[model samples]
Target: MLVWLSLVLCYLAFLALALAMPRHHEQLRGRKPGRGLVWLLRITGAVLLGLSAWPALIWWGNPAVAVSSWLGILSVAAFAVAMMLTYASGWWRTTLAGAGTAAILLLVLPVFLHP
Candidate 1:
């Protein structure tokens, strides 16, 4: 479950990074994002990508496995993001919203369920 959560985070992080580019932002929304929004997206994407590794570390406990798993998850997420951008650009907002909601739920559920 935590691994799956990490995948979602990676997906969202890629999505944010992709949207930070003016061309991609315009492709999806028909206008370039403002400079402030672009910077916000870039920083948020970086932080989320970093945080995505935490789940693997928490789940596997071995640094080697955690790093490798995170990279593997990142590969899958990056491919998914590319496909989405190529074929379903119009759905970006919806996809981001759903993933964000799911990530939040995943982060919270284990705490409540385990405790």
Candidate 2:
């Protein structure tokens, strides 16, 4: 239970970082990101979400394997890519809002359902 909670918390932190990427990128580059980059961020976010959920499914199937923990670690990498894409995109505000909301809901649902 503790490990799963930690994974969820880490994922939430990554989501927050991803949400801030756009504004940070703009300040660094002195220009807005392009539409293409926004799309990239969205795709990356989706991928991270998918990867993060995989571990829980695997844990259900086989708790003996250590692969689930590795998947959780990979989620951090996926979140980094998502953040980079968000920062590179000009549509940071919209993407951040959507992703943040989705992340919160995803993290909360399991707690209530499983508790």
Q: Find the candidate with the highest TM-score and give its number.
A: 1
TM-score of each: 0.95, 0.35
Total clashes for model 1? 0
Report RMSD for candidate 1. 1.0
State how far residue 89 of model 1 sits from its true place (Å).
Answer: 0.9
Worst 10 residues of 2 by lDDT: 1-10
* Candidate 2 local lDDT, residue 40: 70
For residue 90, give model 2's deviation from the true position in Å: 19
Give the clashing residue pairs of candidate 1, or none.
Answer: none
Error of 2 at 53 (Å): 0.1
lDDT of each: 0.95, 0.55
